[model samples]
Target: MAGEYGLKRYFDADAARLLGGRIRAVQPGFDVEGYAAEVDSRIPGKELKDRVLVLAEGLRTRLPADYADAVPVLLAILGDELAEGEGMFTNSWFLMPVARFVEEYGLDHPDLSLDAIEEITKRHTGEYAIRPYVEQHYAPTMERVAHWARSPSHHVRRLASEGIRSHLPWARTLTMFVEDPRPVLEILEPLRSDGSEYVRRSVANNLNDISKDAPGLALATALRWMEESPTPETGRIVTHGLRTLVKKGDQQALALLGATGGEHVRVPRLSLTPGSVAVGDTLLIGFDIENTDGRAHRVAVDYVVHHVRKNGRSTPKVFKLATLELGPGERRSLEKSHAIREVRTRRYYAGEHTVDIQVNGLVRATGRFDLRT
Candidate 1:
């Protein structure tokens, strides 16, 4: 990146040295400096994985002619570099680059690539790398991944779910899983009670990704996991997995967790303070709810702010409030502050923005605020 730096630096001079040394250690005569120069020239303008592939293209030329011979040689070098305690961003951070390397260099040879990818995942992770194999060899690759769900290595178990994420951030989308995610749930079955939190979090994220395209599959998977396991660990997966669906006010998702729909609840008041605010200011939003029926009710209350974009159109983004039970005749006032700060993901435009108070997935009250430039 020209302006600032982040993950792009993961492949730098040090990584070049480490990779060059490993290549030479295994293959007697290799072009280390020429490989280093290509890496240097390619990295100047590219981001993390973009630069990784740029260098991987150069790296492929220097390896042995045999695909099967080259794959294990690289895997052996990676094993040599592994330390006892390697964090995601540590010295062993080389796995991410190595994964991309395999994705590019070893596509023609699935079996060899699969073997190397499994070894890469056990220590760091081959989730991003495994996608190509899954895309190229769908059924067989997934069969191997399913078995990894039961692997003694938590990292391998994590890869079983993470590698197949429908919408994995910073990685290519797995279209097979996106079109039909039933197979993904099959992979998650063995890891529902995974002893490691690392593996469980991966499963939750994979399920969450499934919710974007296949909400039904995501919900069904969560329900089935809960029914089969019925444990606190499995319950956590449901809460995290259905979060996006809950944000969209999916009635089935709300009902799954016990929240009353808007029609069933009574909203007597809704208001936003300081009708007009500056670009980077604070706006206080408040609303009041009352339970009308004789029995208590569980509710998932949220506020949807329809932010105006530069084109004069607006999109709705839901923010969660409180989830609680209201007894009969009991009224509660809930206030959540809105920070009108600038965010990289969302650019704020000067215009009239509307905020709606919602119960379950229903809009009970709407309020407007003018954002001043």
Candidate 2:
């Protein structure tokens, strides 16, 4: 069973050793000491996934129904190394054991209450995975989160903002709140002007999530927040959050930020070497850009490969071409080769496949030709 697990394969040795020290300090047992010694003796940067797996297995079987004993032991272990005074853990690794513990034993202790839930929330923003269990096990406890929003701890306040963000980047989707973010918005309204940048960034990211599915709602919220005298901190948060909308040229977003399109920087001419590609063949695509604009312009150049399906459903996938910093009247030439792979479902239409060069999110040039089977 341990051989099949990839957790240890992915765990970095350095991270494990660091985590092991903390583990040895908190989790008292013969195995923990043995594992810690093994990890400490290993070359730095070795991963501890296997050892953690062993620890997890031990807990799953040994942990009793009354988490009272296990809870304090874990808290003291976490508290000694990670959690000092204000509810901050020592490191992200500290969350691994706790998360594993929660995943394995959460339902067993259905009586878990508000205080325990709050303590776990302080573990990490990525802890959102445990929200369903929290809501199921401790409904009344989660409700009290609104009250804790006013707590002086930045950690608690951040949890209020971040814990509910609908689209936390790189995290799993929170579809429920993304649809109607009202409950969380109440928590954000007060924390928007939070004294800590930590809390403010979370608030901004939360607003950013609201922007994706509901652009109109996001713009309205931004406008509403703008009307009030915004602090510099709040302004930064709002601006960063609205970056996507601003790039997509949302009118309200542009007007509120008082930003408009600048002079169109002259673009370069593009050329493809083969000009045509065969399935399983490599196509070399190249481009030359001459910027005649007097001022320097930053441009993002990319290509969209339009693939025609067997059933004639067309889908385009964007791939990066280049990011250029062109100076006044500069000429730059770039080239890249793309391989054509014959996928099982893809049918070559025996006609021209279109591709276009995109400049800073705008399509500027077009090229097309046939792909032979």
TM-score of 2: 0.61
- In candidate 2, what are the lDDT values of residues 143-177, reduced to their tens digit? 66676678776667777777667776434576677
Residue 151 in model 2: shift from native, Å? 2.6
Q: Positional deviation of 91 in candidate 1, in angstroms?
A: 5.9
Expressed as tens digits, the lDDT of each residue in 252-285 for candidate 1 is 9888877764566778888888899997899999
Give per-model CA RMSD: 3.4, 8.1
Q: Pick the candidate with the highest TM-score.
A: 1
Model 1 spans with C-alpha error above 4 angstroms: 1-5, 18-37, 79-91
After TM-score superposition, the amount by which residue 4's alpha carbon in candidate 1 deviates from its true location, in angstroms, is: 12
TM-score quality measure for candidate 1: 0.86
lDDT of each: 0.81, 0.61
